[model samples]
Target: MKLARLGVLIDEAAMKRLHSYGLNVFERYIEEILEHAGAPFETITDIRALDDRGFDIVIASVVPENEETAERLWQYAEHGGTLIAYGGLGLLARRLGCRQRPRTGAGYARLPEFRSVPAPLRCLSAQPWHAEDAGAGAIGALHASSPQGELVGPALQTFAVGRGAIHRWAVDIPTTVVQLQQGTRPVLHDGIPAPDGTADIDEGILKADDDIELDWEWDREKTATGMPYFAYPHADYWREALMAHLVRCALAKDRTLPLLDYWPEGTGHVALISFDSDFNEDERAVVTLDVLKKLQIPSTWCMIEPGYSPQVYERVLAEGHELALHYNALEKENGIWSLEEFTRQRQWVQSATGLARVVSNKNHYTRYEGWGELFRWCEANGIAADQTRGPTKRGNVGFLFGTCHPYFPIAWCDEGNRRYDVLEIGFLTQDLNHPNLSDTTVIEPFLKQVAKVGGVAHFLFHQIHIHRLEPVRQAIREVVGKARQMGFAFWTSKQINDWQRARRTMRVTGIDAAGQVRLERGTVNEPVAVWLPTSEAPESIQSPGIVYRYGVPCIKQVHHLTREEAEC
Candidate 1:
């Protein structure tokens, strides 16, 4: 099946603002979506270039400013090209069969096609819109509900233009998504309300929980104790919705796009279980290691300063587990929160364990301050992954950052808006045994949601609790069993970091006229999955399985060989 050529038009000026203290998200969010979807796309800065290149699908993320660019896009779509655009397209809106009305300051929007309820959507323009008539040819795919439960107008409208079509999102999706992921910059020092009673205000450190962007009353479902049990994954859901539309449009043109699977060998889902070794509890570490051995699951042990004896570290490595640094930034005793302190701790752990490199780290108290600083420190230190952006309080337990997948965070401080080299694999909740915080109740639902998105379900536990508290020990065992039963393979953080970074290097050059997928792969040591949408399963496949790509059936095949072997 010939795949449609995909291109994202960039607004140069808007992109420039994204790096600065401006609200425009531009192509950053779009780049994130395509990266997660594993779709091969090019970034187009010039509008006229769309003509000669003949892109089958163009994402008009950059709303045309002048008449010439707008006319070019209109002509391209009229001549049979799918154009997916966000926000307003100015005068071109009426020409494409959409009508705009007075904008409203609403907080939410819903895409009924995804069976979605109203999720938090912050308009970068500070105004959420409801389309007027959208004309007769336009169909509303997403809409915002009124106070009395009426669908007043559409946020996303589709219009059939000549031989092609245009899907327009009336709201600013890029800024909303980036906000959902990174949260507001210069986080308020006052901190969000901690009604669940987990906030330790005396710490004087701006913890990760301090910057909770998800609304406690609106974005989460509560438990009996008024703590959050279910956090609606608005970011992930929106991403999936966008990808679904892209796949649908591609299929309409008799094209099938190849998507990269999240896990190796067509695994249904993936999970990561980690332990924070607080105060270097060697005895507690032993008990936890024993449990891991019994379950045959490899885990990541985030070792703090003056970590366990050499024997314990050796045992962790011998058991095929990962030894990662657990940086101490809490105010216990001389716990500093700076790059220099982070480096000192990292070096201490390396010297203590006699290890050459430490690939991952997580803060002691989930201690986070400011935005992008920690990421920059990790980048400088060669830390490939960090698991610090998660809930430290009960009220904001699940998907607080609105993602379960490991992603490279963008350095908002950078003038170029470059993504940090570090990957953030945020955990759902820490210490299920912690009273009023989390328990086994969150396990099934959390894992289910992660599996739904084919993302990594990461859980954190403390060695002290795992050994001293029987309930915590039991909780870990039960979660492991359930995860395995649900087709989730438990992997170390290093493994996940390695896999995601490796997969990012594999490029889909294109799909040929003969229906063959051309690939450009980096040095891959483990299996990477590439899914091709097909009407029927191929007769010959290397470790093939049946899967769905944005609701379309596809045959998933794993690539395990090197570039040379693949060519042969």
Candidate 2:
């Protein structure tokens, strides 16, 4: 099989060092680009020879300002050459075409202090962004050093490439933290190097480009199916690297990867079958509850009680599983509940948990989005999470093609009624699959699949699934055992239960004339993203707000709604 050739068009020491880290054929001062990724190619190095060889990609790693190399490769050869250029990149962008993307996206974790572009290009691209055990990566940002003092980041600027198909910050992803002397490119966020000419992203932090590999270790644990679930995030290091490579590949000025909380994490997909229930107080609930108690596994219950069985619902509370008002009352109406009728059902939940239901309804028969009015009512009433976007009572799948996980609700618990305050937790599995174990006994396969996609198994197990699956129940114990053996951690659903609980407190305190935060409640262990209304600063929230009782920042924003609408 013929392999594709990649040209390394540089003679500089820096270029030589950089090429060592990449894969594929490296051409020095290659004249032409690889014409295709179709098949392997015979090797050729002469710059002029590139025209005849028909290579597809060219990696220009030298001082792009050097007109000789730029003119040769820039003019001749393949339609698009993947260029690893610096100065020449912007120039090519102008020729190849370019546009503006708002700085609002993602990729820039450490924002450069000054928006000003310095005089010289001197900066480090590597600075550790996480804890020591958090593994490591080659962090790159644009930095500059002046004839003056220390180096700092370049100013902020966005440039489009490839007819607006791609976007690059001129966004500095440099590893050198050296102070760049001005005359730098558009990546406005720049930083300068220290006195020593030595500047890597965070200067001197990274030594020997050979040791640099773009990989980060995710703290991993196993899902019930014994597949790995990473507790921490992967792709933090590679995502930006991949984006840069992608832009370089497109050879377009418009190429850009979102720095916003993008979806690099949810790529994997699958679901689990729960083996427990929360609605009835029959032996089914008792048997299922006993196993969950013995196994130390936390499950979610779809509770159904119209002041009928307080002990049953209360037992779910005592059993240590999440409680969602199961719509038994509304099941007859095609499992749909009227807003007011739904309210009466969960009215007794306070007796169970002593707190207003923070989570919403999960319809029985595994129906999805059945009780819309009930959900809306729950939302208006102080609830913030809903788990109804799964199989309806018919136990049908495939209506959901691929998506499975927690997503922001398109609307409140109400159909077609949107609310930003609610978090929609979708159901991935239920108890029916266990007894039917037929072909859809996807308990393990689904769990394994969901784990692959960085998803949680939001199961609605009834008393039957576990209590009956003698072997399967034992299998649950083994799954937990294997997880512990593999260094994975299991979290009680209530912990996340609380996380959803805390999200509602976010408020827009006051807007600056620039629309920056005059006030925002900086709570503990939460995602607090504050943006300038102008959108320049976007939304930036850091840990430790003024609310911190202990010098550490913590507290809620002032201003609370007088009363919340009613919910289950």
lDDT of 1 at 451: 84
User: In model 1, which runs have C-alpha deviations exceeding 4 angstroms?
Assistant: 11-14, 17-26, 97-106, 114-152, 194-204, 222-227, 512-514, 525-527, 534-546, 557-568
lDDT of 2 at 12: 48
Task: Report the lDDT tens digits of candidate 2 across residue range 1-568.
Answer: 0112444444444343444553111122122111110111233334455455554444443433445544555554324433343222444433443322222222223232211211122222322111122211122343322223322322222222222221222433321110111011212222232222222222222111112111111122334543222222121122223233432333232221111111112212322224324434466667767776776766656555532255655776686666656654334543443566556556755555465653655544433222134346666656555555443221222112122434342221122223235445555434433433212333444455444333445544556556556655665565555444433344334454454344323333333343233423223233333211111121244423222111112222222222222121
lDDT by residue for model 1 (1-568), tens: 7877888987676456444564435345688778867888898876768887788899988544678878888888899998887765766766754446655543556554543333444332322243445353333333333222334456566777788887777666665666677776745464756555544433466777676556555666765544465466776776776776677677778877788877666566899999999867789989998988999999998988778999998999999999999988877667887899999998998998888999999998877777788888898888999999787766568887878888877756343666778888989988886664677777887888898877789999998898888888888988898998999998899999988888788788887675557777765556777878764444544434766666666766566776676676
Q: What is the lDDT of residue 212 in candidate 1?
A: 54
Candidate with best lDDT: 1
Cα lDDT computed for each candidate against the true fold = 0.74, 0.36
